[model samples]
Target: MLITIIILAISAIFFVSGKIRSDLVALCALVALLLCHILTPEEALSGFSSSVVIMMIGLFVVGGAIFQTGLAKIISSRILKLAGKSETRLFLLVILATAAIGAFVSNTGTVALMLPIVVSLAMSAGMNPSRLLMPLAFASSMGGMMTLIGTPPNLVIQDTLTAAGYEPLSFFSFLPVGLVCLLVGIIVLMPLSKLFLSGRKKREDDAKSGKSLKQLVNEYGLSHNLFRLLVTETSKLAGSTVIELDIRRKYGLNILEIRRGDLSRHRFLKTIAQKLASPDAVLQANDILYVTGDFNRVKEFADEYAVSILDGHATEETNRNENSLDFYDIGIAEIVLMPTSLLINRTVKEIGFRDKYNVNVLGIRRQRDYLLRDLGDKRVHSGDVLLVQGTWNNIARLGRDGTDWVVLGQPLAEAAKVTLDYKAPVAAAIMLLMIVMMVFDFIPVAPVTSVMIAGILMVLTGCFRNVEAAYKTINWESVVLIAAMLPMSLALEKTGASASISNALVSGLGSYGAFALLAGIYFTTSLLTMFISNTATAVLLAPIALHSAEQLGINPVPFLFAVAVGASMCFASPFSTPPNALVMPAGQYTFMDYVKVGLPLQIIMGIVMVFVLPLLFPF
Candidate 1:
């Protein structure tokens, strides 16, 4: 017991300090328990197989499909249209919309989906996006309180109740609590946000101005380097594969795309098929290759291969014709290098974007200046934003390497705008079916089973672009954190630490009444959550809360509800939740901004839930 207590204490300190990843800290604690023989290997490993972890993973895929198909944005944009010019109305709608989506999706996913829409709407209404964004982040957490699968803490409590042999909560048991939270948030945040978040420099608007495709092309001078070359019957490049030619390596040239004509029975009415250039693509007579390189290199390659240069500047055409850059298969995006990216200080040639990631670096944006020409030998610096063009699949692959760089804005949103919007209805229907299976008792499917089925259906029904895309949606860090921390709760219970803690609480506060005990548990959980993950906090406190109520001879439901509410309601610090951290830069918020705006909301919520929970669920 002493060993377990020491391990828990060390882990808590590390969690609070934030010097290490929370998931790593939790795993180390789990391992210490095993090494101390406090838990068997099977006991320590049980968390990885827990249904709460499985359900969370499945829900991530469901939520990803919702965003990938653009269903969430379509629904959110339509609902926000009602806000129409009233900043107050828009503010109310932002919270409601974010919370509503958050109830069904992960709060992080909810905030990400709603961020741009809220920003655009706030700007249109002449309101600072800062005013709506913080509330937007808060509402996602509030919304997560609405359903069984809404947040990890709710799942922890549900698992705790079931393990104690009590009747488990139904899907909507949290709806009332969530409703109260949303109402309280709407009432409290309006004035607080206006007072604290409204003061921002005029540079805010300029910061939000992300570049468009045409702007990127012009800014990079891609048009100057871009040219069209036609392969003739006599050309050596005809009937050769792109890899066989090795133009990129041998001639310092990149074939960005290819346009070929398909002749119909009426030869004059031939249709052109555009394909993003790939290594395996076969060159044919009359094929139009969209190439980018230095003028001398392009000229030499054209001469060597007997290929004719069709136009020096065919990219200037603005029509939706065969000559323009087609985004159907290929796209361009900006990626900003992290301070620790291995590619930093490495020249473009050494990094080999084409050979390594199958993408072309069109230009680099370093602060105010843009480097467009002779990019081969340019040494990359930290914070350099590179404009890259490739197949959307390849661009998305680049985005997944989060340690090296961050793909700016929403690449999925951009892709959905052109290609995947047709899948929105399918994704919406799958989500509705999952909700139905979870909500209806007669369906005979468990909530976790329903989530798993929905996730598989999301991929099979083409809601996501591919299986890998579905898997990419899951945040492995949070999943592992929750999974690894769950075993600590078992260790506490097995070692009698939970009972000891509960006895101390009961001995200290039980004489005061159930309300005092409830407040103690709620406030303790909330305070711990501000430092560690809410899910981890809930896991550690839930067994203790259960034992406290059992000792008091009152119903344990209200106490457990207190645990969930407290863990989910953490808002005084930006590091408390993923949604809070996500909005910090975009909203131009300082740490004190969260304290000034979020501290009041967090305290008010605790006070309200402490009084309101027992009324809803009797002690």
Candidate 2:
């Protein structure tokens, strides 16, 4: 018992410090107990096969299927359109849509797709992005509180209760408290959010003034190296087309543009300078060639052919060709580092950021300042904003490698547009039917079986683009954390530590009545979740809360409710949840932003759940 208590205390310190990864901490605690012979091998490995863990894995697919079919994008767009330029309405719509959608899908997925849309809405509505972003994140968490599969924490508590020989909470068991929290959060956050929100600068002003071509050339040292030449009648290249010459490879110069006179324009009439020049344009007398490369190469071409460098002029037209758009297949993107990103503290050079992701790091935004140079050597930190240039295909591929990266702003024009997937309604139907079957228990099978069937149906119906993609959506963090932490819970029980802890709790607060004890459990869980993964918090605390109930000779249901509600209340800190991290970069939000807005809601939720759970469950 002393050993169990010592191990748990050490683990708590690690969780509270937030320096070490929770999964690593949990695994270490499990290993300590294993070497000490506190648990048999089967007991140590039991959580890997926990029903809750299996169902959470299955739910990832059901949720991914809904979003993969592009159902949320289509629906959320309509809701925003209905909002019709009202900032208040758009605010409500963002929260409502994110909340509603998040309840059914992974909040990270919901937030990833919604971040750009909400930013665009805020920009158009003439409101600061921060005013709506934090609430959008908070609402997503509240929405997850509503459904059985909303968040992994909910399942952890439910399964923990079942393992204690109690009837598990139903699919809709969380609805009442979750609905109250959602409505109250929307009401309170919408106005209070404005008081704390601030932007680094106006987005519109920054977009308009971003960087000019001449400025880029000066900074990149390209001046005097680019030249335009005119093709004369005596030129060997006259009458030959660019594609015919293969001038790019043969001459070692990238042709920027070709200007022709009105009389000679017929030779190259179909060209558009804004887009890349077509190789089919036939060279003609009086046609001007714009190219950039080593001066020696340009001079050689000029001397060999009947051409003269159009000297003493490098105007705005040339300046306009200075950006990455000048090169084919190059695209720029902004991505925010996740709070739990593995890239944190790792230098871009160390990670081979350029080669691995095929992106050139251009700038870094940390806090309110933007760092434009030496970014490759700067060690990345959580919430560090990165400006990168790469091919659009490379950017999309990078976004998929992990949850650590979230693609910012718009998808590239080169990216496949999110067309209305005709399979959306079918996907929605499959999801709803799965939920109904589980809630009603009408399938003559266990609830987990129904969930598995739902996941399988998603693939068979083509809800997800493919089976491989669906598997990628499963949150391996939650799986590993749960599997690692459950052994600690088992160690607590097998060594009588659970009873000892419960007796201590009862000795300290039993006289205050079940209300006070419930409140204590709720507040402790709530505070822990603000610093740790909510799933881990739930996995560790739910069993203790149930033991407390047993010691009090009352029903374990209300105590379980307290732990569930507390674990889901991750509003007090941005690091508390994934959705919160998603919006931090776009909104330029800081830690205090969450505290100023989320504290009151956290208090309100604590008060209501403590008083209300007993009435519903008769503790």
Candidate 3:
């Protein structure tokens, strides 16, 4: 027991300090437990296969697909429209909308989905995003209180009950408690957020250094040089690969993308496919190619290949207005050459960008001067910002060669924002089906099974761009943290450490009746959550809460609920929850910002839940 307590104490200290990664800290603690012989190998390793962990993983994929397909954004944006320039109204709606979505999505996913939208809306309303961002983070936690799958702590409690031979909670078992949490959060957070978060100056760097796509296009005069060419029936370009044509080398023309239409089984309907122009992409009749080059060179190339120039006067105004260029499959980014770059004096052709980097140098920004055409003979200079275009994956590779050049702005974040809106309907239908399967007991599928089915369906139905994209949605850090920490609970139980802690609690607070004991459990859990992750805290304390309730001759349901609520309601620190930390930088929030706005909310919530749980569960 002493060894177990010492290991847990060291782990808690590291968790609070935040120097080491929490997941790493948990793994070290697991190793200590094994080395101490407090747990067998099977007992220590069981957490990896825990149903709770599996459910969380599946939920991550489901939430990722929902966001990737733009369903969550559409719903939130439409609902936010009702706020209509009223900051107060916007505040209320932010809380309500976040809570509603969070009940279905993980709180981290909920905040991530809503962050950019809320920032955009807050700025449009002429209010600082900070006014709503903190509340947005808090409301996600409150929202998680609404359903069994809403938060990890709720699952921890449910798992505890089932392991103790008690009835497991239903899907909506937390709805009433969740509703209460949402209401309290709304009432308390509105004034607190306004008082503590309003009128903060935006960070100067908040305006990203990278130019927007439209700005880049206009500055480089790309629209004036870009043209569309059609591959007609008699066109020599048909049935030939781009490599066979070697247009870049022979005609100074770059094929940016290819647009093709194919007739579906429903012959009247045509599905349009847009793909990045690769060297091996074979051209066929009726294919429309987006090409960029000098007007005369493009005309000469089209005439030689028997292709028709579809748009003879494709002016900058028309291209900008129509938004002809998209970054779905391919993307563009500007990279500044390092002072010591080996290619500093090399011409574009000499550098062989196409052969080496698989990207095309479309333009160069040398201070105020822009060179859009005749880029092949242009010499690369130090500190020159070259606008390169290629597949998003290839563009990402440029950042890895940091010694040569630095890619500006957040290319990956920009890529993530490109929504697959066409798949929204499919994602919504899959989400609805999963909810139905879980909500209705008449359905034979388990909740975890329903989530797994929904996750796989999301990938199969193309909600995400690819399977790899789907995998990126899961936060492996949080998953591993939970998995590694779960075994600590088993160690505590095996060594009688959990029973001893519960006995101390029962003896200390039992004389004051169950209400005081309830407060003790709630406050202890909440306090611990402020330091470590809420999921880890719940894993450690749940068994103690259960043992305490049993020793007091009371139903463990209320105690378990208290544990869940306390473990989740932590708000006094930004590090307490992922959502809180997520908004800190964007909202320009300081540590005190969270303490001033969140501490009172935390205290009031604990007090309320302490009284409310017993009434609802009838201990």
Candidate 4:
């Protein structure tokens, strides 16, 4: 018992450090318990193969497919479109929409998807992102309360009930208290709550930086690298497509655009140009290719392809037409370095960033200072926002990397990929099938099997382009964290530690009356959740709540609900939930901000849930 306590204490220190990875801490603790004979090998390894873990993996794939297909972005546009310019309307729309989506999806994924859109919307409406974000994080939690799978705690308690020979909660059982809690949360986070948030760029200010793309045409010296080539009938490139030519990879050059008719404006020239210039378009005779590359490769490509180089730079200063090179077609996006990004503490030059990624760093935003120049030498830090520039193809791929970098928002002009755009319906269908199979139990299928089918279908139906990308979409850290933490709950119960804790609660707090016992259950669960994953907290306390109920000779339902409700009240700390972490960097929220706002909400929720649980469940 003492060894277990010592192990957990050390693990908690690592979890709160913000230096070591949480998954690593969990793994170390697991290995320690196994070595100390606190747990058998089977017990230590059982968590890895748990149904809950598998279900989360399936959900991750399904969620990634939906995200990649731009479904979330489409929803963002439709809802915010109706929100108009009123911050109040936008606030309501954001909370309602994020909550609605989060109930069906991972809250972390929901927040990651919405953060960019909300930030952009807040900027457009001239409001600080923090004002909209706090409600967003809170509402996401509330949304998870609406369904069995809304959050992990709901599932944890439902399964716990099932294991104890009680009927598991139905899918919609969370609706009653969840809906009421959501309404109360909405009231608490009204627009007036903005006073507690940080001041940032207003809507009246130039929001182009805070809102959308900031084009820097000459920043990367791309002008000097631009070269125009005229392909003749004898050119080797005349019969090939841009992708087939692979000029970008072969010679380290970016083909900016392809123009046909060679400065001839016969009106048909526009039609001819349209057919031959896009990245997928084929090359033809009389085609003029606008390319950017090193000077040596530019000359080599022209010579090898039997093409002629156009002397002097093609600038809007010289050409007055639509095809004029006036800093157009440049793609720049803001990406924040993930706290766990490997690129941290290293200079951009040291990372071989430009050569490796084929993107140029325009500026770096570290706290208050926006370092535009001298970026290559400056060491990058976690949470630093970067302004990066590249071709549309190169820039769009950055959106796929949710692990190392948090892409702020996509540029307005960049088109969604044809595969992802078209596959949205397929992904939606798979998700529906998974939900129905789990809910209906039409064929007595295991819940994990349905998720597995959905995950497999997501990849098989081209919703995810490849297996590697599908794997990349899962948050391995989250998977490891949850899987590794499961054994601790089992160990606590096995060692009689959980019962000891529950006995203390019944003897000490329980003597005050059932209401006081309810408060203790609620407060204990809530406090544990603020510092650890809510799912782990629910697993630890749900049984203890049941044990307490047995001692008091009342229905366990109220106590169980208290555990669920209290565990979900993870608003008081930034690290309490993944949604909170996702929004912290984007909203520029401080720790005190969470305490100032979330602490009150947590206390209020405890009081409300404690007061109402007995009435709802009838102890």
Q: Clashes in each model (backbone N, CA, C under 3 Å)?
A: 0, 0, 0, 1
Among these predicted structures, which one has the highest lDDT? 3
Off by over 4 Å in 4: 55-58, 98-141, 144-174, 188-467, 527-557, 571-600, 615-619
**What are the per-residue Cα lDDT tens digits for candidate 4 across 1-619?**
7888788878877765646776788899999999999999999998799876777677667667776665555555666679876777888889888888777765654665466567656655667778888778888888888888888888888887888898878888888878878887877778335768745543343343333331333433444456778788888988888768867557767665666543344321112222224345788788778776677888887888788887654543344243244322345677789899998999977866456566667668789776754556789999998877665556667776447787665553332222254455666676667666655635597767877888898788666546877897677776777778778777776777655665576568977777888889888888767644678778888887787777888888888888888888678766577676556655656556777788888888888888888888888
Greater-lDDT candidate between 3 and 4: 3
RMSD of model 2 against the true structure: 15.0
| Cand. 1 TM to true fold | 0.56
Query: lDDT per model, in order?
Result: 0.79, 0.68, 0.81, 0.71
1-619: candidate 2 lDDT, tens digit per residue? 7987788778767755667765678789888888888988898898788765677677667656666666656565676679886767878888888888777655654565465456656655667778887887788788888888877888888898878777867778888877877887877786688666744455553342334433443444334456778788788888887778766566666565565534333422222222223455678787777666677777887888768877534643455432212322344456789898887999977866655665666567788776654554689888987766555667667777748878665434323222215567776677677656654534586657777888898788656545776797676765666666666656765776654554565457756878888888888778767644677668777877887778889988888878878888778765566566556555765556667788887888788778888887786
Judge candidate 3 at residue 311 and give its lDDT. 56
The TM-scores of all predictions, comma-separated, are: 0.56, 0.49, 0.69, 0.58
> 1 or 3: which has the higher TM-score?
3
Candidate 1's C-alpha runs over 4 A off are: 84-91, 98-179, 187-326, 331-419, 513-518, 521-602, 611-619
Give lDDT tens digits, candidate 3, residues 381-500: 999999988877888888875578899876776677677665777787888788777656688987778889999999997787789888988877667767777777677667876656
